[model samples]
Target: MSFYHNRLLEQDYYPVVRFYYYKEWEGFNMPNHSHEAIEIMYCLSGSCLIEVDGTTHKLKKGQFIFIDGDVPHRLFVEPGKSCRMSNIEFHFEELETVFPSFRHLVSEHEALRMLTESPKSYLLFHDSSDVFQCLNALILELDRKEDESVFTEQLLLGQLFIRMAELAAKQQNDTSEQHVYIQKSIEYMHQNYDRDIRVKDVADAVHLHPGYLHRIFKKAMGTSVNGYLINHRITKAKELLKRTNITITEIPHYIGMNSQQYFSTIFRQQTGSTPKQYRRESRYTDSRTVRSEHFKQQAK
Candidate 1:
């Protein structure tokens, strides 16, 4: 299952994942080199045009492009064109923790259906300076020679993946006859989560009946609209608890919970701990609560 070419690799420089910058002159044709890992290339400076399976797209500064595993593609830098790109090549396994959809091989011909893009697609228009700074920092962390724990860096990379997915969904003009209605309903629920929202209100936004909206939301969000709303409210409550010393009574009002009792019930069910227990357990007073007298090796 290894995707590496043994002829081009030796023990010294074999990398399952790597991050580096590349720049080259015009008229460069990378005549179909193949590899095992998915290639994510971020154009850092200048521009180029790429061809993937007879489809062409313009690649410019700040756009990140994806080349699925083993899919043949080529890059071209036209006359007077200069390209400097920060590229990360990593195995699909590294992506599993973030995207559960990638747990199985959907086959080379069907990989686009899994990620919901063309075989070789560019998630263009994410040309933000702050975003690139974060990506650059992650690249530096990935390529460090000194061995260190990469858990945090991988987490950041996962977040970037989520953001990229969002951007792509916005740009994709899914003209499918069936999916068009589903997409419209999803957008409505996302935008109106804060106020006293109703299923009818959401359904009207997408021209669907309320009952149909319930079934579709469950399928698409992987949860019902009501379920997602409750989770979103709970998420906001937890963030408030962590950042501020807000009382439990104040939380329900701030986060739009209907009642304190309902909030406590949901919190206990979801978090397995009541609000008071959570706040108490989260705070540390340096062994004030740990009453163990037999401690000879304690802090001197």
Candidate 2:
């Protein structure tokens, strides 16, 4: 017998924005997950719960949360209690015609930058009376479904996001700026996981010596440079092992892992399952789940 636990609503679609609006209910909990589209939820008039990547936040009325595509998130509602929120899902596009800032944001690594820095996820109405009122109106428009043109709603939502971005940018005081070099190095390793991504190359890109860079990166990110690189490669390798039909033997070298044994070793270190076990247990991945996520973008 197969048991599917609580999971995110699964669907397939391309890079475009969509809108959802409603009141929430109690005992409403969402399972943890990552997706290709960044998600936004606006809380109207009710109290509920929001969980993102294991962190919990108490959601009150007139608040919104922005979740990055890579983040694993969940939701919860109290039983018999009426709770509601508007959900908007959208993909980040780089096409100028599709999205004006898509190209620059993509090239500049803006998305990741925001995830690590921005605190605009939760828009509290009390904090800004005017913005909160506007958000409420937007939520109302979203709920009516009277608009014949779907794109019209999405454009309005995009405007809301633009305003949020402007405020968050001004308020951002990146104490983490000291770790910028380390973040840059980490992004590089992630991008070249399929090839020989030497620490020297990353260090060179960040303008530091390999030895110095390794120490700084480990201290800042809490994982050794080599270990972190291996971790990402193995994680990716595992995702492919279960999600795709690619043979295990062929998966390693493609992910910068030299041997199946070594790949299996790190796989065990990070994930309790061996590569073989991972593949077997991957029944949960199924075609339905695979269809929702695209190949994660690499840092350029």
Which candidate wins on TM-score?
A: 1
Displacement of the residue 107 alpha carbon in candidate 1, Å: 21
lDDT tens readout by residue for model 2, 63-124: 67777666677778778765676676676332323433432332344433363343333332
Q: How well does candidate 1 score on lDDT at residue 244?
A: 79
| lDDT (Cα, tens digit) per residue for candidate 1, span 86-156 | 77776633332332222222222232233443333333445445556666777777656465554556555
* Model 2 spans > 4 angstroms off: 1-15, 94-99, 103-155, 169-300
Worst 10 residues of 1 by lDDT: 6-15
Q: State each candidate's clash count.
A: 0, 17
lDDT of 1 at 87: 74
